[model samples]
Target: LSTTTDNGTTALHFASVGDASVVLSYLTELSTLKEINQQNYYGETPLHWASFTSLAHVKILLKNGADPTIKDSKNNTPLHLAAQAGNSDVVRFLLEQKLVDANAENSCGDTALRVACEEKEL
Candidate 1:
């Protein structure tokens, strides 16, 4: 949990992107919110990566202290990325988490609802 790549990408981030929920859960168990929510060069957290990977992964990360409301460098929340990825289940799950700000806008002033509509999932 103390290791990172040049971009500050931790094992949790990689595992989230790879949809390795088991590994993510294990790593998250050994991590604090600061470590599990560590952002990469792009300011994306494991939850951000998992938002487009797997709902199961998102759930694990969320249950393990990953913050659902963190914004990336672009100010896009996990909800935005999930919507952009057309992961309806993930988008729904994220919204249900309630910690996420559905009204939150990105750098382009686009809300998660707008992003979902753009992805044709709304």
Candidate 2:
């Protein structure tokens, strides 16, 4: 009953990016591989989408065993994405993990906090 593309972009990804409620039936109240937050063609994990979009999936995915410190091919972590997106909620949640590098910079020498500040000022 799943309809994902070649790269394995599942319903979870859409739910994380759009209507989270759209996946509650499949994500919540269950513990299956459906909860597996894998990467896409862009090397972006489910946490990346969740964070990048500033969706509540931050805590949801973490609670479901998502790694907060996982990075993408561009050396950008979930915290980095969230920061760039200016989602204060996701940033605070990631900070609470105590595992993220507050000064962790990307290949472009941009840290999560730095990107957050820069994007906000823009």
Candidate 3:
């Protein structure tokens, strides 16, 4: 139950970052569903890392009860990170969540839509 890296990142975070779906599945079985949303030292949850990289991991995390609205230390939600990363698919999935705040502003006062627009010009 105490397994984690120096930054407090769990195996789940590594699984999400590496796109290790099978590892994620097994980890979920061993850990509680709440662990799926555990944050690291940067206050980034597994979903936050997955949001920019894998739509499949995003879906899996959400399905397993990851909270999309949980903010990081910078007050950036999963949707916020997805938008900043220009991940349209992950943004769409996060928007579909009943708890998602589309207009939620981060510490910088940037909403997901605003970030998406800015990212488009880059």
| Tens digits of lDDT, candidate 2, 1-122 | 25567886766667677665537445634535445556677777777888876556766777777776667888899888888877777788778768588888888899887887888821
Model 2: how far residue 85 lies from native, Å: 0.9
- Tens-place lDDT per residue, model 1, 62-116, is 8888888889999999999989998889988777757788899999999999998
By the lDDT metric, which is better: model 2 or model 3?
3
| Leading candidate by lDDT | 1
Each candidate's TM vs. the true structure? 0.93, 0.79, 0.89
Model 1 pairs in collision: none
2 or 3, which is superior by TM-score? Answer: 3
Number of the top candidate by TM-score?
A: 1
Candidates' RMSD to native: 1.3, 2.8, 1.8
RMSD of 3: 1.8
- The residue pairs that clash in candidate 2, if any, are none
In candidate 3, the residue pairs with backbone N, CA or C atoms under 3 Å apart (3 or more residues apart, or in different chains) clash, namely: none
How far residue 70's Cα lies from its native spot in candidate 3, in Å, is 0.6
26 Cα displacement, candidate 1 (Å): 0.7
lDDT of 1: 0.87
